[model samples]
Target: MEEANETIVAEFMLLGFSGVHDKLQMFLFFVLLLTYLVTLTGNLLIVFIVWVDHRLHTPMYFFISNLSFLEIWFTLVTNPKMLLNFLSDSKTISFLACMAQSYFYFTLGAAEFILLMVMSFDRYVAIYHSLQYAAIMKQRLCIQLGFVSWVGGFLIISSWMVLVYKLRFRGPNVINHFFCDSTPLFQLSCNDTQLIKRVDSILLSSIVLTSLCLTMISYASIFYSILRIPSATGRQKGFSTCASPLTVVVMAYGSCFVLYGRPTGYLSLEINKGVTLLNTVVYPFLNSFIYSLRNKSVKLALRVAFSHNKTKLFPKLCCAP
Candidate 1:
């Protein structure tokens, strides 16, 4: 009788976007699937080019490869559960599992954010001080920048992760959004989340404001130099190099601000999630397309590889022709 009264269980249902229209599910599934395939292909191609080609062994490409890997991991961190929720009527995740999910999501997201800023700085150095770009952005320095980004993200996000674990949840376990976003998670917790809210505000503000300022400063100088160039061709070349990185920065920072920096409210939850998904999908696709496809060296490498494969498959035809 005593055992019957006590609840014995772990894990809670995630009421994803299931309550919405039925057609929405099908639409979301197709959209997410398409995005996933493109993200995977684009990021993997970048990693392969960076690893196999000796000429791409530079600080810029090194950071680009790292960004590619991070984008794939970023998509995985959120998309699988989202895809699962879209298919399943009742989605569930354990308390510990949810906390772990939140941790990894924020950590990886923050790391990539910092890495983008570092890449901007790299471009600034290369453009303005081309003579000293090698000495300044050496392999050792690139490695250090990557390490710092990861560690900084971990240290900053760990506090909130701990806060999340400490909070109590007594009522509905259903998270409003698809994945365990920090804002939605805060809403679900029963305890007073004032401190967590303050901390989160500070952290998100620091990420957006500081990074935006730095990127803006770099671009301000970059654009100034481009304007001073007497030759139209020189100016166009400078602008073109800045275009890809600037596009990435705008997309990343804009989405980040929409998702995290804004005030948390019941109405905006779904919209926020959608914005995040857009950023994750768009950044990887655009980066790979813009930076790799347009690059002469990468195109040459791909062409060479394709020819080699073709030759191997038709060795007899080569002699006949």
Candidate 2:
């Protein structure tokens, strides 16, 4: 085989939402800015609540805290750059910077996939073997599982990024998407990317599809276990506990599989952009609300934290001194 020439391009112009009218771009700027802020605050609040509230120190909340932390960095990796691009006339990102963004973006995403699976297992153990749940999901085990998810995700993506870095980009440095994703970046490569494309498809499909399958299986077992419970209230409580995470799992995996599960040739930039928005932008913001608002423990924790802060801030007023 002939050698492919290396990329001469030093920078890439991220043509983010250039198709949108200026007014709409400005509208999107604020909307995305607000969304980012909310995503940060919400996910951070979950982390804080989990940290301070002893009631939430179970294996389930432990996994949630990890997910919330992942969302913080996950949203941070892309949104700030996308937000800046929306405001600026020059949407140029250095090739190295673009690659870095892509690396972290996929890394965090993979971590989330594994973390969600860990959470499903936590739920399964909690329901399936209630007596042994505590024994099985001890603090050391939970920490190890969480650590493996983060490390495994990074390792998986690191190998893929090495391939991405090797691909040559001769010219036309405009990426027609908000971020440097594998699909868009692969489209820009000048070399024979057939091998990389196949590798990417297989890796993404294996990680996402496998995790999704495991999650579904865990939920199935949990559901069966719930059915065996004679009390309606017990069943309702069981469903309530599982509902929020299940919703998140569905949303996260659904968007991801649609975007990354298939070959690059099959993807449309317009549709991909919309799906990216849902997966990256919308889901992070929604995750906190889904996990927190629906959770009684989280609600109570928030109220207690708020009251504690209020008392600290205005002790005399609160105490009627």
Candidate 3:
């Protein structure tokens, strides 16, 4: 009876596949390391390409580059620690550190989606208000939009986080998922969480739905305009502009809703981890390819950017001394 004492959880253990065999863990470590590097490389390359090539200075490319920049930091938040977890047995993150990780993770993620909505509206203007698009989406306006995307996502998630931070946490502080997401945090709390649950749900759902609905409306209008184009070349050109963002929107929204919107239990945490990896790691890697390969303009810009670099790097090769 004297031994029955509850130890407060000062730090949380990230149970990231601790039970897996050594061989499998090593294999996964390498794979994850490769994925993280590639994800960073891909997103960074896109941002670099956009920066080097002046032809990509338009509103569309600006948004794409903005997204690529955001994704670079976004992927960085969780992968390094995750990679460390596989290589070493010590997979513990302090309470404050864990809370901060969760905060930044959601903040960047929400910013990405909000930026998507901004992109959709950009596309809508490009198609719908064709003649006035340049006039409407001027440089100052673009900067403002970019500002809102980052700040808007921050504020939205911050609201939920404020209340979440106040919640009481007792012992047995092992996070089921790899990173410190809200779902596991809620599950870990000792206090009553129903009010907080509803708060988070309302916040997340509102943001996701608003962005989704706006994106749909924007795309629907864009498609309508494209279909009405009299010339086949004109229609094809119109469709090409919207292709990359549309693809990204689907991947982003699909993962978000499935992982966040639905009911979650310990049984589903493993599944959520897989989905989170896809969202953070694989998704960013795919985004770079999608934007660069699918769009002719980006591809052309990349070629020009690389050819210029090659010329600078080795003028003797071209000159043939």
Predicted structure 3: clash tally? 0
Worst 10 residues of 1 by lDDT: 1-10
Candidate 1: segments with Cα more than 4 A from true spot: 1-9, 317-320
Per-residue lDDT of candidate 1, residues 100-202 (tens digit): 8889888888887788888889889988988999899999999999898878889889987888788777656777777777777787676899999898888
RMSD of each: 2.7, 2.4, 2.6
lDDT of the candidates, in the order given: 0.80, 0.91, 0.87
**lDDT of model 1 at residue 289?**
80
- Give the per-residue lDDT of model 3 (tens digit) for 263-320: 7663376788889889978898899889877778888877887888899999999678
User: How many clashes in each structure?
Assistant: 0, 0, 0
Candidate order by TM-score, highest to lowest?
2, 3, 1
- Give the local distance difference test score of model 2: 0.91
- Model 2: CA > 4 A from native: 1-7
What's the TM for model 3?
A: 0.94
**Candidate 3 Cα outliers beyond 4 Å, as residue runs:** 1-6
